[model samples]
Target chain A: MTRRATWRRRISRMLLRCLPQLMPADKVDWATAMTREFDYIADDSAALAWTCGCVLTATKMRIIAMVASFTNTPHKNAITSVAVLVVTALAVTLMVVAPRTLTPAGGGMAEGGHVAFWLMYFWPVIMLISYAATTRRGHCLPSGFLLLSLICLYVMQIGTALAVGPAMDALFHAFGANVQAWDTTLKLALLVPPLLTVLQWLALNRLDRTLTVRSMRNDSFAA
Target chain B: MTRQRKASAQTVTVLVELANNSGQWLHGYAISTATGLKSGTLYPVLMRLKESGYLESRWEASPPAGRPPRHLYRITAAGLRYLAATDDDQVSTSAATR
Candidate 1:
């Protein structure tokens, strides 16, 4: 392959990687739409710039959204709230203690850390899939569920990246380790929060309308 | 059907563009270029308008060989009615005496 094509391939692979997760479930249609547009663009430089901008924007958005969601709307129910807290506590403990404390033990702790890692990884993926499916099927109830879950994932990712990249980079560099190798990966992971917030905000507003209509139908039937 | 709310500037831009070439099936990218809205903003606005019954969209019958089929959007009857109603309201409210 030519040098420009190689670099463009790398740019597409590295930067737009987390786009699937950053994109809300319902907006997955736009994902397909954008991929085509990106491909159809004549200028490689413009495409690279757009891809990089998307990554940067997505990451910044998630941090702000997580804070807002936490401050404004905590939970719909006590049980789910408590359940989330317990699972989160368990995951954090596994992620922190599992690798260092039990590396000698090997599989179990390492695998536990992996599980914790994938929870945040697959969390948004699952919500996004749920949204795309439901929106296609004309199911609004699960669409709302997917929307809320995605916003949470955006927040979770922003928190994880903020905690992971810089802290780990500093820790490794202090030991004279080369942290430069991780800069690209760190950037891609860090830049995931923004895209979904716009979609999440749109969904959040319209979600109530669907819910109200469903509830009204139930009320009429009861009467 | 409920009368749609007043169009935002972005929405109006899209509408004006579509109404200017009414009945012509303009692709999303073409509309984006015409309206000067970024694809990011334009797609969401288009999707909302489509969902709100102000627009209709369909995939192109035959796309250029290399590119994927484009989605063509046009204003629906309800959409034009909304534009006309807003225009009528504007005309009635105008006054040289005032």
Candidate 2:
């Protein structure tokens, strides 16, 4: 198979693996449709780009599913929520500190770099929002807005990264310099979304287990 | 599961598909494309429909390929009533008429 086709296939398989969590339906139909869409792309660049977008969209969907399920189950204890909050705080702190350690002496990040730094916190903010959306027992307005904005922001983030990537690469080449901090910063910026998602997946599984046990106990008592 | 929250546009779009198809079994991919719903949006809506007793699904055997069978779905009687009660002709009044 050609390189582009191979890339698309690999990404498609990875995304399909996550489909079962969000989709109750058999995964085969989604897989077939994803493959057809991938194979239909005529150009290599377009195919590769489409693959990236598909991965992001799928991951976002998976997180949203986790949030909904997590919210549906009433928390018998707040330990899980507290644990996630602590981890999120630490993550935010490390994200702020780690990139600075990579900076070349006397060299600093540009304005875009500053923006990216703040944006790296997007995952934490979304995590907080998800917690609020699911855990709270009140009107849904705040959580609803949070959900909508985060989705929009993530889509915009991916779009902006794709659009600015080539220009950033060209500019760096023009500088003809090895910038360690910039390199680390860019990598962290991209990593935030996926890292947050993995955290969500783990939290969901833990809470789900707790929920199941609680329900089982209630059932036994009822019997 | 009987969430009476007003159906979002995407949910209504799905209802339209289930309504139009009536007794016909529609696969997820077909619904996804026809309703312009993403996999993320489409799947959750499907689950809700099932939970609400508005839809039912069964596995349809696949081709010689080793992949798992596909999910075939159809709207239930309650689903038709939902469509009829909340019938928005803009989506497709035919769904209500049926």
Q: CA lDDT of each candidate?
A: 0.55, 0.56
- The CA lDDT at A217 in model 1 is 64
Candidate 2 structure quality by residue, lDDT tens digits, A101-128: 4344467853344544666667557655
List where candidate 2 sits over 4 angstroms from the true fold: A18-76, A79-223, B1-3, B62-67, B92-98
lDDT for position A136 in model 1: 44
Clashing pairs in 2: none
In model 1 chain B, where is the ten-residue run with the lowest total lDDT?
B89-98
Q: Compute fnat per model.
A: 0.09, 0.03
Q: B-chain TM-score, every candidate?
A: 0.79, 0.80
Superposed model 1: Cα runs more than 4 Å off? A1-17, A45-74, A87-223, B1-4, B87-98
Q: What C-alpha lDDT, on a 0 to 100 scale, does residue B14 get in candidate 1?
A: 80
lDDT of 2: 0.56
